[model samples]
Target: MQPSLLTSNASHRQYRGPITTAIFDWAGTVLDFGCIAPVEAFRQVFSDAGVPITIAEARAPMGAAKREHIALILKEADVQARWQAHTGHASNEADVDALYKEFLRVDEINVAKYADLIPGALDTIAHLRARGIAVGSTTGYPREVMKNLIPLAAERNYKPDFVSTVSDVARGRPFPDMILANALALATPDVRGAVVVDDSPTGLLAGLASGMWAVGIAASGNEVGLSLAEWTALSPAEQQAHLTPARAKLERTGAHFVIDTIADLPAVIDAIEALLAAGERP
Candidate 1:
């Protein structure tokens, strides 16, 4: 028999109670939908290193620890070819190291300026909190960057019960390390009860692999310069033309549900509640 796509049985080996916590990804999921700061900073860093990468390309490493993310991009198949094409230079570990430092500095300084709470983000968070659901935040950003944003996020009336960094955990997305950490921090004993909301495919896989509810918020205004609907409306060929890299990620890490904005979270919550009512997993 074919395996059921929606029902999670194996991953959630330990049957637990309903989900009472929600794990939120920082950049595209909550704070800023477009991820303006890191994307622009990475582009500049790459340009300075003689390899000009677009903001879209720079976001490939998102949802993973900073160093691991950097390594992924530096070792990408097109690393040498793209570098040669854009900058007429060959990139090595030393070049990657220099780019890393510049990117970090720019990220630290620029993150604050890019803080736009995604539409309905704060409202959804508030709604969950009011319902006694604990909200926790985890990001591929290092501690410095997360700490820098706390004050800003607080000013906007959105605060996470636990704020953690990717470095705080052993591994990053596509592995359940960060989600596990957030679960522990939130004291959520049941995986089914916790919801993981993210915009990255890796992040969605991480949550799903951890047996938590994964909600993919494919929001518009991505630094990639196209709205989510705009990207989706194109012909399959056109869509593939624009999102080859992102599509590769998605194909590898399929999400349970795809949504265009945080505004659509009510439907997600309704589904989770229904699952709970049915006693399927949660």
Candidate 2:
């Protein structure tokens, strides 16, 4: 006999009721409508180095840590060729480090230019707070950049309880570190009772990896590459073209929901709560 190993039932505690906390990504999701800061900074830094990467290339690695993002861009075939042609050598770690240093200098001054709180962010955050849902934020930006962006956001009436950044943890997006840092700082009793809302695939992936529900922003974020007014000005058919693919991209990241902007977040929150009450786990 195997000592009746199957006789004992394993039991574990779980939370099933309502979302107690919500974690948001900064740019594109809440503060910056189109996630413009990093993109502009990336493009400027590359151009200054004489590599001159295109906007599409600048945006392709939107949610990664800044230095890692630069490295990813350097790995691209087109960018690599351009770098070699311009510098007489293939891009290397030192080039990445140099570009990243420039990016820090540029973005620290540039982020404020795009810091307008996305329309409805304040209201949506207020709605969550009203229901006793603790709000926290995470970002791909480093601490110094966040120090600039956070106050700009606060002045606009949106302030998250805890702010986590790439610089605060060893790894950033597509990793669970920052989101888990938020969970810890916000003191979410159970990770399952938390929801993460972001505008990038990497950010959403990080949330799911942390065992939390993940939501994505489609039309208002990097995927669509448009501000609120620019998005609204598009013809429905035109809007559909960019939006369908953007939504699909986020869905491919395994998000629990995808909405156009943070404005639509409260409804998603309600839907998630309904599922939670039904004993669902993200």
Candidate 3:
């Protein structure tokens, strides 16, 4: 259900960067804990390679383009040592491809199975649109997933003005290609008029690199390492209870604002307006 807003005489203060458009990340940020399903798939491929990793451990590299994140994980986890112990062999390019294929399969199937908008997310998007802002979305989700999910999104009437995929970008998150593409689509006179809302390091990096204001969604059920089921089981109250720590953690990520939920979005917008009115950049 959409959030109800009572009409009031209060003025809608315009801010220099009150975010005329918002770009969203698909999986973990908007589409509910999508990283975990792909983790299970990667586990299968890695098991065949004689390396086993927990789904929890596997959620760490979210918001990055898969291949880029996998390369990062391989180096960080000393995959060479793991490979030596597991199969007395070094990791190969072919292993990466095999794991990638498995990961993509899980991502594809689970896009429908698990794709619920984050609580308050739809309402927040609606509120932004109601205020005359364009809403755009970009995702690490490849075009194949978009083929199914875009139709689903349209069925729900939460459609965005523009959508871009990681596959369409030269470099994905942490490089700003997808965010930049979405910003170009928004086409506002000032780049600051749009904001990127994200929950991961790579996403924040992308927003900052794109030179757009960034808001970090730091809701409780979305702490860095939780799986989908764990997040879903938390009641809204419980989720709100967890937001404090998430906010603190994300503050270090350099976001202009750290919001516990999309419900807090209006307040953040007000803050941005205050900043702009004072001739300060947010």
- Answer with 1 or 2, whichever has the higher lDDT: 2
Q: lDDT per residue, candidate 3, 1-282, as tens digits?
A: 433342342234334555577787766566565345455555666676577766644656767677655655565555557866776666667767777777676667766666666667678887888888888887766787688888876766668898999899888878888877877777865666777877776787788787777888765223544555675688888766666666776777788887755556777776766776665654
Clashing pairs in 2: none
TM per prediction: 0.80, 0.95, 0.82
- Could you tell me which residue pairs clash in candidate 1? 18-193, 19-193
Better of 2 and 3 by TM-score: 2
For model 3, the local distance difference test gives 0.69
The model with the greatest lDDT is: 2
lDDT of 2 by residue, 246-280 (tens): 99999999999999999998999889888877777
Q: Kindly report the root-mean-square deviation of model 3 from the true structure over all alpha carbons.
A: 8.8
The residue ranges of model 1 lying beyond 4 angstroms of the native Cα positions read 1-17, 82-90, 221-252
lDDT of 2: 0.90
The alpha-carbon lDDT assigned to residue 167 of candidate 2 equals 97
lDDT string for model 1 (1-282, tens) is 657743566545645345588888888778665666677777777777777765556777776676666667776767668876775666667776777788888887778877767778878887887788899877878887777888888898888899877767777777888888888988996788888878777788888899888877654334233534455577878755655544444445666565656777767777777777666662
Q: Say which prediction, candidate 2 or candidate 3, comes out ahead on lDDT.
A: 2
> Please, what is the whole-model Cα lDDT of each candidate in the order they appear?
0.72, 0.90, 0.69
